[model samples]
Target: MILKRLILIAIVVLFSCSHTVKGQAPDAVKKTFQAKYPEENDPDWHKDDHGYYEANFKIDGIKYRADFNADGTWVETETSIDEDDLPDAIKKVIKEKFDDEKITEVEKVESATKGLFYDVEFKRKGKNKDVEFRADGTILN
Candidate 1:
């Protein structure tokens, strides 16, 4: 009986200490993003296969990807804006406003058809802001 009780206690402790595979808390991910890209904000963060965090955003109508380590440091980034996929107006506006800001993450929201846009995230002027722009480049609050 004592052996069984001890085994049960060990199992409970192990499970309690384990990190959930779903990912860490949202704030933790946000803090990590902010630390790595101080100029960007409101990134859509998700856990990738390697158990690291991945963020998506757009800058100047260009899609960008940023991968973070478990501790939230930047692992890698890719910047490639597909003009054919993005509306020309949005492309133009982004180019005009955020020439220096780097696009870090993007998400295609399906809630509204006509207003469909890439939720662009960027680092600019030592601050971070979430900019929602229509495919046609209309900024939405």
Candidate 2:
């Protein structure tokens, strides 16, 4: 009886865990993603908190994450980037405004609504902050 109970519990756990990951993206989302990323064949799909289908893939050794709506509209794409790769305009803003904060991470973002921007995460005195900047040095947030 104990062995049977253990096996049942294991099966329940496995099914629950798999259920979370196995929610396949909609056909529209997959079609749009394929059109956008022709070279990447396989992408790990996940539904974000906002109900957007996110595709995590790699291109030329660089990792990328793209979000698409259920209706097949592309939302955004983001990729980690080095600080030195930032535009001079953005660098100037960081130097001028965020000089006191230590840079933690940077990502280049291309959004359907917001166009293109850089997301710069900073750590200051045990607190974390994120700043978004356009390529021309305009701050969005």
TM-score of each candidate structure, all chains considered together = 0.37, 0.82
Alpha-carbon lDDT of model 2: 0.89
Candidate 2 pairs with clashing backbones: none
lDDT of 2 by residue, 1-141 (tens): 999999999999876553233238888888998899999888988777787888888999999999989898999999999999999999999999988878999999999999999999999676788999999999998
lDDT of each: 0.65, 0.89
Please, what are the lDDT tens digits per residue for candidate 1 over residues 14-113?
A: 7765434333436666676677667666566666667667777665566666766765555666554444456778779889987777876555543313
Count of backbone clashes for each model?
A: 7, 0
- Candidate 2, 67: how far from true, in Å? 0.6
